[model samples]
Target chain A: MISSLKIVEAAENSGIDQNIILKFILNEWVVPLNKKELTLDEEDIERIKLIRELGEEFGVNDEAIPIILHLIDQLNHLHLSFKNNYCH
Target chain B: MKNPYKILGVKETASLDEIKKAYRTLAKKHHPDLNPSNKTNEAKFKEISHAYDQIGTNEARTKFDQGEPGEENSKQQWSSFYNTQQNAGRYANSYADQFGDDEFFENLFHGAHQKRRAQNQDINYLMDLTLEEAVLGVEKVITLANGKNLKVKIPPGITSGTKLRFAGHGLTENSGPPGNAYIMINVLPKAGYIVQGHDIETELPISFMEALLGAEIEVPTLYGSVNLQIPPNVSTGSKLRIKGKGIITNTDVGSQIVKIKVVLPKKSDPELLKAIKSWNGKYDYNPRGEK
Candidate 1:
């Protein structure tokens, strides 16, 4: 787990705005490991990075972010299901 | 309403299996989640989803084929049909939760920012990675289009189609903040290795003598070379699995599968020919089992 400060630093290194990161956290787009302590895991960091990408790179609005993420989650689930069926 | 078959890119005479395959393919292609911020693709996705809902199953297809109603009366008929078949609850829930919201469509189509401020355009940056680099994450400095150098960290076990985003590194406008930069990872194919999921398959060429007489040979892996033991009398195309030598991901580790290919000497020596003739005379071996 990483602290919120570390997330901010990583975001800054990636040229993302600190405010945007905070907003994502508040919006539950980037869920923290601990709400009080505000910690994040690698998965959370990756998700935040994806959300940042969608907003900055794809110009996706805040309202559309959740919908898009949900769809992606579903797609990933489908892929995993397919892989599980054939791999083992 | 558009024809269900046409929307899914299938013929009316297509079988249920064909329709299902078509729906899955089209859904993956135009899924709003995969192609975010693209209204046209989102609309297409919605259309496909609706068409699938109309004729996905046998009963649904039968009803649709019977000509339930035209475009004018489809709205009421679809609602009633959806209400009657509770089994379609899965699709209904997803559609209603995601695309059925009026606010979502408004935001997607005609949000306040649509007319007021132009969002920054996204920048796509392509990055090539070797198999080793992909297996083990690497950090490198990348120069953006705006002449700014930024250090990027690539995660381990990244495969093709993995997109990493660098926030606020995209085009900037006077109206709002800068856009994001996406790093699309393309893992170059290795000559000897073929990656299947987390596992790696490679061909190991061995001499015929080595196959007949067991030998330990060095096999190449993602990290380095390791010695692998070959059993005596092993046939060509035999697979040897080396545990925990394939891909390393956050959750699981894969193995390396080495396929053995027995190769004979290019030129035949006189001594070898004479020895082979004597051996053949001593013992008649019918490899083909025809006798």
Candidate 2:
């Protein structure tokens, strides 16, 4: 688990604004595992990295983030289902 | 305006579940987060979203099928409603009053950045690895486009298409922080080995005498060569499994499967041929089961 300060550091290292990460959390784009301490896991880090990529690389705006995130989640679910059914 | 059913890649008479499934599949494929944004994918995403909005629910589908004015008008009217609902808590004034025009509102919702900050561009680096390196892991020193060298530690058991990210290793901005670097792993194919999940499959060639006499021979694995006992009369294309000799992951260990291939000698001695002729007359064995 990583703290919010560590997330901020990671955001800074990745050229993302700390405030933007906080705003994403506030907007429910990236929810922390522990709401009070704001602890994050590896999955949350990956999600934040993706969010940063979408925003900085793809120029996706805040309004479309939720939609894109939901689509990505659905895609992952579909991929997992297929893998479970066929590959396993 | 495109047809909703065509945009979602479903028939007009498709059920609600079919429509939803199609929409989810297409939306996942063309989602901007997963893919790099281009004109075609962006347009396709918009079309899909619009189609879903038009016919996502049973009521909406029925109205759309009926070609009613109420549904069409309601679709156009929802833009302002969405803007107002999305921006209600953030903005003091209504979106219409603040933006003053549809063009600006659309830009604000889609592309316009509220607070402009100088950000370095993220870099994607392609890294190729051999099958052995991928299974055992390796350390690689890569030189970036900017002439800087970075040493990367690749974890063991990494599959192809895995990505490793290095924070703050990309281009540096004058005002803001540096960007990140991503290493995309590509595993090259190896001869005589097929990777299936964590397990590995390889063909083990054996002489016809060895196959008939059940000889213990050394077979190659990822770790090293190990001795395997072949049963007598082992046929070609027989599979032999060596447990715990495959690619190792965090949770489970895999097996190495060896496919047996029986090889006959190119030239047969006259004495051996004569012996075989005598043996054939003695057994009267018909492998084909011909009467």
| TM-score (2 decimals) of chain A in model 2 | 0.78
When summed lDDT is taken over every stretch of 10 residues in candidate 1 chain B, the lowest stretch is: B84-93
Best by TM-score: 1
Number of the top candidate by lDDT? 1
Error of 2 at B71 (Å): 44
Candidate 2 lDDT over residue span B119-167, tens digit each:
7887999999999888766789999877899998765566788767777
What digit string (tens of lDDT, one per residue) describes model 1 on residues B25-129?
A: 999999888978553465467668878877899988887888773442344433433342233223223445443344544564575344546668889999999
List of clashing residue pairs for candidate 1: A56-B180, A57-B180
Pick out the ten consecutive residues of candidate 2 chain B with the lowest summed lDDT. B85-94
Q: What's the C-alpha lDDT at position A56 in model 1?
A: 46
Stretches off by above 4 angstroms in model 2 are A1-88, B1-116, B289-291
